[model samples]
Target: MKIFVDRDKCQNHGLCAISAPASFQLDTDGELQYQESFDDEHIDDIEDAIDSCPLQAILLHPDAA
Candidate 1:
């Protein structure tokens, strides 16, 4: 799957990082960073991260056709 975050909508709250530590994190500068792609095994965690976004900034897409 693919993960995308809207920088304009996100506030760097780190909820995604908390929900999916294996896939997302806040850099030392406090900027949000994450895997653009992820394994299927991480789907649940990634979905949790998506749901955790208060701004609804996180989006999930299937692998490109």
Candidate 2:
């Protein structure tokens, strides 16, 4: 699937990083960084990351799933 983090809506809370380390991470500067696409094996982790976002910034689109 495709992962889209709305930069304008994200708060760099790092919840996504906690939920899905494989796809989301906080850079050295403490900024949020993520993969635009992920494999099927990571769907559950990705979904958890989406749910953990307090700002609801993570979006999962099936365009590439």
Instruction: Write one digit per residue (lDDT tens) for candidate 1, span 1-65.
Output: 69989999999999999999999999999999999888889989999999999999999877788
Give the CA lDDT, 0 to 100, for residue 35 in model 1. 90
Per-residue accuracy of model 2 over 1-65 as CA lDDT, tens digit each:
58999999998999999999999999999999898878899999998999999999999876842
Cα lDDT for residue 41, candidate 2: 95
Candidate 2 similarity to native, TM-score = 0.92
RMSD of each: 0.9, 1.6
Off by over 4 Å in 1: none
Pairs of residues at least 3 apart in sequence or in different chains that clash in candidate 1: none
Cα lDDT for residue 32, candidate 2: 95
lDDT at position 3, candidate 1: 94
